[model samples]
Target chain A: MTVVDIPPPLPVRDRTALHERAPGALSPMLTRLAEERATGVLVREHGTLHLAEGRVVHAESPLAPGLDVLLTARGTLDAAAWPWTDDIPAATHRLLVAGLLPRGALELCRLGALYDAGYFALAPSSTPGRFRYGTTAAAGPPGAVRPLRAVPVTALERETLRRRELLHRIWPDPSADGAPLIRADPVAPPPVTPRQRAVLDRVDGVRTAPQIARELGRPAFHTLVDVRRLAAAGLLVPRNTVPPPPPLPPVTDPDIALLKRLRDALEAL
Target chain B: MPGIDECLLEAMRLPGARGAALVDWTSGLALGTVGEAPGGDHETTAAEAAELARLAAEHGAFSTADDTEVTPPVEDLIVSNRDSYHLLRFVVTSFDATVFLHLWLAREDGNLALARIRLGEMAERLVLG
Candidate 1:
């Protein structure tokens, strides 16, 4: 009998992730901000993150739903009772005085939305991210509700990495993350959980995962999970690799055609 | 469910309660925390607990008929050791709330049955935006 030793391809655990993939290493600007204790907004092409004293106060992205959508979807915020703007602090104070909303609940919602969108905001990008110090009117009406305790930038980055790792484990293909989903023609479709079925029902071949998440008021990452699983089950049109564009029609060079015809005519002459 | 802080504070009032937190299982993010953490770190404890919660919530073996679109399949889970116990109860809300209340209590002094009952009530009343 021979004893053979084999090594795993890659250790996909969180601990290994910490050492192998440095948190926020992809975005050096955020680390620099934390060192300076800078208070301002970090803007990228895809999204923006608000920071106060180097901690993440708020974050928003076009790719993920905002706090208002999540709040409305949960049916907790009464627009009349709690009219809110960017100033989370101010809006929260008003709601507290009105005795309509709990500060803790609002904070938690903001936190969830913060991380949800923050994940997209901190994604690796082609362009350099810009940072502006000092609060702007856009930061919130001077009294916008900020999270009671700001989350460390590093922590948010770490969590974002963890989410990406989890999604990759579920399905390695990255196409479904952005592609408009269409059902696959499986001989027999696999069954999905009630929650996943809801996700599948919204597969209109026009809406991507993020759009579906906004419509459903679910966290975008969860929606991605369902999409990946659905893809693995042959429920979604699996684009294993990015499909190449169709070939262009042959160009008609009239001069060459006329030249060849002229040469033939001369030879006949 | 009760707002994050309030629910955690309520759990702390229970006998032998050491620490409590409201965590989102899917994202493994701790919404809020109170008292002392089992591992002396709230964030790490929440993430670790979320792992167990996700397992119970997603697996087919522990799934019950009571499971519905909005309701989580497993009501709660209990893990006990020599000197402590961890109680996790899933919360149901209008939206797909993938959150649970985690309570770490002293083994000898904690009332397991009472904590479980109260944790369930807290989870039921928990309100999230």
Candidate 2:
């Protein structure tokens, strides 16, 4: 008799019970999947994450436009010639055969899109949706699908934190993150860097950071940082209707002495 | 012919290579990294290097005579300390010249001239689609 080997069957769960889990439960579910070394697609309400051996190899979300759109935006791929499909390997091979880009460039763009969309996918939304773990060959939703080098879950989480911190450092106000970019007067035009100028040119007072990023064929995170910096520089129109208060004047020596005396007097009282 | 990872690995193969990273200067993000970081943290190192690159790329004083416009004026920057040398080689892409390769080398064994030539060639050949 000849011996043969067969892979084990995948675990399956109905969709009805998936939503029964508590809202904002993706972190824990992802942790569980990572622990099991699960290989499949994790489809959430906002987007989908493709995993291989418990590592995220690709991700897609409406918030972050797909690689095809980005390439088209850059004029590398003619919009009419671009291929639209959910099959990542096929699309990748098609792009490669057309001599549109090098293998490394494709890999970089895939990783960039994965991280960009991953940030939004893992974000805390108003309502958390269900997740389905399909077989290893399962395809993601109909959107931009590109293959990426598998990234560990821990690294993705760390990168997300880093991006959040980078945004906060540039401008603390999170309200402007998704808001439209409007031109405004800054007393005098603030000195702008070349990159910021490029971003400013794209600002039409209608598109949000992510949208502008898609149009410019740049990473969404990079666009967010530029918008925040422009806001901080007083270049973009303020998100709030009311203007910010004028900066306080520098305190003189007399003011410091006065403050010290007031503190001493309060202590004595 | 080389991918980002392979390029970084090639950089590390250089004499006295300590660490290497492919960074997007605009966003201060590391696309990929290899070996140990000089500042003990790759993120911090990348951010700091990006700041330097931005400053050099923006300043008019660094602009070349042939190029009156301030379009990514500087091609590369080299900073040397007592123990190590930091090289920031700008890579021009079809879309934007916002990416660069950062390599940290120990002074004792590193050849600054050879490293500079190799990085320049790598930058010219880099393809980010």
Q: Which candidate number has the best lDDT?
A: 1
What lDDT tens digits, residue by residue, belong to model 2 across residues A1-269?
97787877887865556546533334667767877988877776566777777888777777777777666786766777777776654575577556577656666666677788888777766665455665653223234433335788777777777778788888898776787778777778877766778788877777788888787787777778888988888888535556679998877789898998899999999
* lDDT (tens digit, per residue) of candidate 1 on A1-269: 98787876885646556556554454777888887888888998778888888888788888888766776775666545546576654555466455465555555666787888888897778899999897623233434343255688888888888788878888988789888898887898866777788888998778899998998888787788889989999898634345678897664899977988899999999
Model 1: how far residue B23 lies from native, Å = 1.3
Poorest 10 consecutive residues of model 2 chain B by lDDT?
B64-73
TM-score of chain A of 1: 0.73
Task: List, residue by residue over B18-87, the lDDT tens digit for candidate 2.
Answer: 9999987766778889998987999889988988997898766787777533248688999999999999
Worst 10 residues of 1 chain A by lDDT: A136-145
**What DockQ does predicted model 2 obtain?**
0.29
**Candidate 1 lDDT by residue in tens digits, B70-111:** 666788999999999999998776544588899999999999
Q: Per-candidate TM-score, first chain only? A: 0.73, 0.71
Clashes of 1: 11
Root-mean-square deviation (CA) per prediction: 11.9, 13.3
